[model samples]
Each structure stands twice: as C-alpha cells, then as structure tokens.
Target: MITTFPIVALFILLGLAIPVGLVMALVGMAGLHSIGGWDMVSGIVQSTPLSTAGSYELLTLPMFLLMAEFVLISGVADDLFRAGAAWTGRVRGGLGMATALAGAGFGAICGTSTAAAATLSATTLPAMIKQGYRPDVAAGVVAISGTLSMLIPPSVALIIYGLIAEVNIGKLLVAGIVPAMIVTFTIIATIYVLVLRDPSVAPAGPAVPWAEKFRLLKVTGPVLLLFAFVTGTIYSGIATPTEASALGALAGFGLALSSGKLNLGTFRKALVRATYGTCMIMLIILGATIFGYYFALTQITQDLIIWVQGLGISPWIVMVMIVAFYLVLGCFMDQTAILILTVPVIVPLVVALGFDPIWFGVVMIVTAEVGLLTPPVGLNCFVVSRYSGIPLSEVFKGVLPHILAHLLALALIVGIPEITLWLPSHMN
Candidate 1:
C-alpha cells in the first residue's frame, strides 16, 4: 500500500499526531509490505535496524549527546555564562555580546539549538532581564545565539549531514570552525546595532579589571578544556572523530565529577537524558534509513534530479532553490527532521551539480539556523517565548533582525565557498 506513494501517508500521519520516527518507520514497512508482503517487510526489518544502529558514524551522535547531557546536568553552562558576562558585560550592548560569545563557548556542551537555547535561557535570561536588558533582546539573543551550535565543532547537524552525504566526517567537523566563527561575529555585530539604536534595550554593564576578566575564564575552563580536547584530537589527526567523541564524553563526565558538580542523582539524570536524546536521534536515523529505502525503490529523487539537469539551469540557481526549500521547510519543521528528510533526495542532486559536499553542508546548516529564527514554528524562538513568557510575536520580532543577519552571512558563504571550506582544506 505504501509503495504506491508512501509520502502522502507520511504527511497524513504527521498531521494526525503521529510521532515522526514512528511515521517514517510505518510508511517504510508498509512500502515493503506492498512490494513483497510480510516476507519483504521482515527481511528489511532484520537488516535495517542493525545497519542503522551498528554504523560507526552513528556512534558519534550518542557520544556527542552524552557529553552535552553531562555538561548541562553538571551546571557547567551557568559558570560558562557567568564567565562570559563578566568579560563582555561592560561595553555598550555588552550583555548581548556576552550572550553571543558565551553561546560559542557553551555550544561545545550542547550541539542542538533547542538544548542550547533552553540551557541559555534558564542560565542567562534572568540576569539579562535584571540588568535592564529588554525582554525581547534578552530572549532573542538567547534564542538566536543557540544556533551557534550548528556551526561549532561536534555539531549534530553537521555530523548527520556528513553521515548522509558520505562526506569526510573529520573534515566536515574542521570545516565548521571558520564559518561558525563568522556567524558568531555577525551575531555580535548585529547585537551592536540593536543596542546602539536603543541603548535602553541593553545598557552597558559595569567594567571589570583585567585580572578579574582573566579569572573569569578560569570559571569556564573545564568546559573549554573538554572542547579543546575533542577538537584538538580531531584536528591533529590523533584520533578518529569517533574516538574523539568518546574521549570527550569521558572527559566531560570526569570534569563534572571532579568539580563536585555531578551528584549521583544528577549523574543518573544525565544518563537518562542522554539515553533519551540518543534514542530520539537514533530513531530519526532509523526512520530516515527506512524512508531512504522506500525513496530509492521509487526512483523519484533521481527522476527529479534528471529533470532539473535537463532544464540546463545554472547549478547555482538550483542550489539557491534547494536552500530556499530548506528555509521554507524549516519554518514548519524541526531542523533535524528537515535535514534528515531532505538529505536523501537533495544531496544527490547537489553532488550532481558539482558543488562541494562540505561547503553545501555548511550552507544548508546556516540556512537551517535561519529557519530556527523564523516565525510560527521556530523552535528557538518558541524556547525563548516559553522561558520569558514573551509572546511568539514579540520574540519573532526581536529575532527578525538576527535572521536577516544570518541570511546575509549565508549569502556570503554561498557566494564565496572558501569561507566554509578553507579550514577543512588545510586539515591534517
């Protein structure tokens, strides 16, 4: 039944409150059943789960999630935010800048935007609000800043992209560094304008002594070390990305315990959180795998690609359209689901167009980041709204400027692919 056109059922199920994972899985099984009855379905079920679960690349997802869960459970995010606030708090638009900068640091702890936004909102929003920062600015900065993780090392989005596209995972991880830095700078620049236009929105904070500022880094040192440890091993070719993730998770756990921040209960909680998060991610992957199988059986993605190629449109035009599609999809869906669902179809088309996979990955991730800031279903914006009791309308208003800034940055990345590819090119 599903093989006739599983996609219709997919959306129908999605509309009916079916979980995305289960929906994909069901459509896939149904497609197989349509093809060869229960025999085909059973054969695929036996093969798919093991292949999906046993893949080495998939190992990174759980480890990354575990490391982040431990860090959040340990309350390291708070210390990291405080350290950032102390350093950048004194300048015009200081608190906002600090939020962006601090996000870069804490991005290492959480690779997903929602996790970072929630952690940041709980950690920094109250302080920003108390400091006379406008609620919208405070909430917007927290929400938008959460996107830093998309470009940061160990990014979940980048990992999944690399896995699906069969790109070099280590190189993709290295590739994200410069672009992430670029986005961070763009965000800070945006913050400056937002504050300058209305100082009342985010008045300058008190200046701190140089010694005190340096000391503040100490407060965030453990998490930073964990980041450095993971990235260093990956960049220097000392370990595989998989190895680095495991090491990083262990280091995160050790840091939490040694610092007396992780208790037995919290440790258990982190494990539970990590398990749930890992399961959520794995389920999505399982669904995507099944969906991809059904998609391949149909050859629809190939036909579409061939059709686009026949049109002789500039590959760049096609690329832009592909990104636009992502932006539109991002408005209504989670970034992860958007990326996973589209990758099977879109990536092959991108590869056929002669674009570098790593660069396209960065571009798509940036576009997805913009989606996180867009209206109606913007998860990060919703996170800010829930935390601050600000209406989504106001939160979206505050984030609109930043979304424009991200779009500008995305244009730069798309135009000059070097911005996204330079570091990975030189990677060991």
Candidate 2:
C-alpha cells in the first residue's frame, strides 16, 4: 500500500504535466513523511540536494554541455554537413547518408539529441529538400540521425545512467562507441535501401571534384581530432571521464574562438546555457535521489527481483519486457526523466538476473534513442519539424523506417552483449 501510493501519485503528477524533478520530489517526500513522519522528510530534504549537487561525477554534465554549446557556436555543424555532402553527394541517397554521417560527427561533439536534430534540420534538411529528396525521407533522416548523440561518447544520457547505476562512467562512455558506430551504419544502410526502392526519394547529385572533396574533408580534421583526444584519453586511462570532459570543453572553446564565431556575447550565452542545463539535470538527480531513498525503504526492488526469479520464465523474456516498457514509456516521457525514474528500480533487477549493467546501459540508451523518434513526444521529430517547417505528421511518417533501424541495432546489441562490452573490457 505504501509503494502503491507513491507510484500512483507519480503517474498522476506526470499526467498533470508537472516538472519531473518536482513531481518526484513531492511524491518522495510525501511518501517518506508517511513512512517516518516529518523528521525523516526534514533530514532527507536537508541532505539529498547538497549531496546530489556536489557529486564530482556530476561535473561531467555541465562540462560536456558547455563543450557542446561552444561547438554549436563554432559553426562546426555546417562544416560537418558540407564535408559529408561533398564526399557522399554523388551516390544514390548520398545526401541522406551524409546527414547520418554529419549527425554522427556532430553527435560526437554535441551530446544532446535535440541539438543534433535542430542543427541537422537547419543545415542538412534544407539541402536534402533542395536536392529534390522526398520531404518525408529527408525529415525522417534528420530526425533519426539526431538520436546518434544519445549513444555516442560524451553522451549526457549515458553519463547520467552511469551515475545512477553506480557504474564506472568512463567504461560506460567507452561501451557506447561500438554500438553508436553500428547504429550510424545501420541508419546509412536504411537510407540506401530506401533510395534503392524509390530512386526518386533521393536523387544523386553531380560528382564533387576530387580536389574540392579533399579540401572539404580538411575542415573536419579539427573536430575529429577533438573527438579522438577526448575519447582516446578516457579509453587509454590517461584521464578520468571528468578530466576528459574539462579538456574537451577547453578544446571546444578554442575551436569556437579560432573560428571567430564565439564572441563575448556567445561565450556568455554558452556559460548560461551550460549552467541552466546543469541545474536542470541536478534537480532531476536530487529528486531521483530522494525518491530512490523512499523506494529503497519500501524494499520493492528486492521483492520484485525475487518475484521475477520465481516466475520460472527465461531471463531474456524478462529483458524484452523491460525494453518494451521503456519503449512505451518513452512515447510519453522525456528520456532523462525516464532514466532518473527507472534506473534505481531496474538496475538492481537487471544485475540480479545476471545481466551486465554496462551492457544494459547501452541497451537502455538505444531504447531511449528510439523513443526520441517515436510519436506523441518524439522530441527529435518535433525539433526537426519546428526547425524545418515540416508538418508533425510528416516528421513522424519519416522516422518509421529509422525506428526499425534503431530496433535492428538494439537487437544486435542485446543478442551479442560483446558488441557493447568488448571495447570497455579492453580499456587500459
């Protein structure tokens, strides 16, 4: 009955369109007060926010967000898309492939999917449309491609997952590299197949001169070097994830400065945006921590795990059910909110089933990526539609195929845990 109240209240508050952090905090405090009166609630209210905000691991969030903001101001997204188009534009559906490639590259630097989607929509979507690509195809490609940021290194989602699940943030970030690459390729393949089926969807462009292609490629070097430096240092154990994030932020600022795109005003904007993003995530973490305390007090995770074990079903079936739950929940909730609300309950249950938390983190992210493209609250789709002037229906129409691509990638990761675990295991 105690657990039932909080869960029901959570749903009711969420349905009321309340901010996730406040909703969780209110329900949690109320639940705690119910369990142990105002004394417990007072103690929790005093300690939880400070502890959550003060985490060293949490520093990674703002640094990476700052890095991404600076990179956004740097005009790197435009360069990435142009460079990609130059190389791939002559092939059938080449521009769409270029969008995926550019999206992946931008995602390497920009950790947020909405930013990636908006950037691509502004840069690549127009180009694809002007090139006579089908609007739905173009919009779908842009929307789904943005999801790469959710799985790529320096991913904010994965970082938050690591913190909540109590896994190594460095290894968690490293584990995403291969899965991200596979997803990028899968998206590119999906585009190819789409064009193959209907050549009119993405008509090939005139070939780029070899010289011009090489010149365009040169512009991508710095971005690539920055990504390599950040991920490499972490993989080589030369820097902790937090150290790498600071270094990456420094590099991003340098790039923005060198490009002459970041002025005093832009610099201020970056800091403010980073600060705002950090505060938002911190609040979510704080509320989640409070709620997590209430949840732990209820002893529900242990009971749920025991009940599942006694069900006499295959663990894989249970895993599928969990994934389905995420997929459905994702349709209506923000990805970060989903992670904050569920990781505490799910991670322990997963570990009890003998699943790797690291691998499961990757799977969780991939599912979240899918959610970002699904309807009703497909954030990336809405971003694409808002930026590109595509109808909401068309944006959703376009993402259907890429959603399948995401599923295919998810299946591969789920079936072969090694795909996610291999690189992290070998990390120095």
TM-score of 1: 0.96
- Using TM-score as the measure, which candidate wins? 2
Per-model TM-score, in order, reads: 0.96, 0.99
The regions of model 2 sitting more than 4 angstroms off are none
lDDT string, candidate 2, 62-92, tens digits:
9999999999999999999999999999998
Model 1 per-residue lDDT tens digits across residues 257-317:
8768788888888888889988987898888888788788878789888999999989999
Worst 10 residues of 1 by lDDT: 1-10
- Candidate 2 yields a Cα-based lDDT of 0.93
> How does each model score on lDDT?
0.84, 0.93
Would you list the clashing residue pairs of candidate 1? Answer: none
Clashes of 2: 0
